[model samples]
Target: MSQIFENLPVKVAELPELTPTDLQPIDKRYLKVLLIMQSIIFTLLTIGGAAIVYFSPDIEPTLLHFAYACAPTLVLWGLSAALTLKGFKKKKYALRERDLLYTKGLIWSVRTSIPFNRIQHAEVKQGPLDRIFKLHSIKIYTAGGSQSDLSIPGLPEETALRIKEFVLGKTAEDGAIE
Candidate 1:
């Protein structure tokens, strides 16, 4: 029993030795698609605000009143749009020998790494806007809490599939008999 315990191997899971500088940025078309989507939503919201000012019976249609109502939305929209555009530039991901690394954000940056050995599954997702831009996102799920999972967006469809396959292969390889 003592000999068996002494011979047992130990495995330590460390984050992949990769840095933000080593990561590759996402496709440029993603930024354009996001801008278009935001523009459409902005248009709708502006129209809705205008309708509220025009149709309300009790409130007078003063320019100042309209400005007060619309100003905050416009400001928030502008800030959000600007941050989205800048955020995409910083978004990046990479597949390493042991895990996948993803980094993204504008003001508050975040970096996440999911080990291939611990991954339970990989999924590729695309929304209407993503379809229009030929983009896909890969979601990697692990055994732990929901926060441990990683979602990498703005990948080209082909790239997303390639990454998905690679992760699946790694998972299988880890489970195979030596």
Candidate 2:
């Protein structure tokens, strides 16, 4: 058992080794904004929970005490979101000719590989919300439902199209690098 634990590989650091990487660089502001939104949500829930404890004198005799106990969930929720954002910032992605690799998620960090040849269709999409945020999403449709559509988000519009074209074998005036 100790030998098995010793053989486990060390984790890679998050800083980019080169100027370009396959993964979209999310603005750190996104994580910050998300943290704020989460905090607001927990604040609202905590307030509501306290109100229940104050107003419901009947249930307070029994089950309501547990409800009041759940008030601490607000702090737990906020801390959970904060920790998740930290984990997300530590992830990275790489695009290769044969396949694309991405790492995402919180405690259960996932590393997914989608082969380029298996990509059936691709598109560069931007909605009203995305446009407002100056962000773009590139969707790559693969062979199966498991990894069917790869949505690479928080990219610039031009970069999204370039990735779309690269997958489609459609090059721009500047060629593949553009």
Candidate 3:
């Protein structure tokens, strides 16, 4: 006996679209967390630059020299802060019946969707900064890797836990989890 395989073509135009507006935005406080982290990093960079200029044998420790040494750090920090503020609005996520979706970016947008059947496990994590901000992040892992396939950050602690439980339940229902 012989079996024949049939392949059907899908109509691309008939598929439903996932628009940015359809997704829910992350917590607004995440922006504050990001700005604080950026400020801390830039402060350290500025201090290091100042020290280098002050101690250098070749360079005179003048106000002009200090300004020149720290100028690049200040400029870069300003640019980074601006981009972080602008890009924060672009981060959004959605939990659909069949899959989880996360989208983020300003200039280069990216959207990731993972179906329930492919999800092996989910976890909610909070760092020191996240704890201070009362925020949590959810990480979803699929098969074949120790690293999570997708991580959605800047969520309330309760929301993150709820999402993690939902994903785990879905995975179990789909027989992805034993």
Question: What TM-score goes with each of the models?
Answer: 0.83, 0.60, 0.88
* Weakest ten-residue segment in model 1 by summed lDDT: 8-17
C-alpha lDDT values of all predictions: 0.84, 0.64, 0.88
Best of the two (1, 2) by TM-score: 1
Per-residue lDDT of model 2, residues 105-163, tens digit only:
77787867666766777878876556666767777777667445676665677766777
How far residue 123's Cα lies from its native spot in candidate 2, in Å, is 3.5
Clashes of each: 0, 0, 0
lDDT of 1 by residue, 1-178 (tens): 3354454463223323466567888889889888888989987887788778878997788998789768877887899898997788788988887778998888999988877878899999998999988999899998867878888888998999999999999988875656
The residue pairs that clash in candidate 2, if any, are none
Candidate 2 worst ten-residue window by lDDT = 169-178
All candidates in order of TM-score, best leading: 3, 1, 2
Error of 2 at 118 (Å): 0.5
> Which runs in model 1 stand beyond 4 Å of their true positions?
1-16, 19-21, 175-178
CA-only RMSD, every prediction: 5.8, 8.6, 5.1
lDDT of 3 at 15: 52
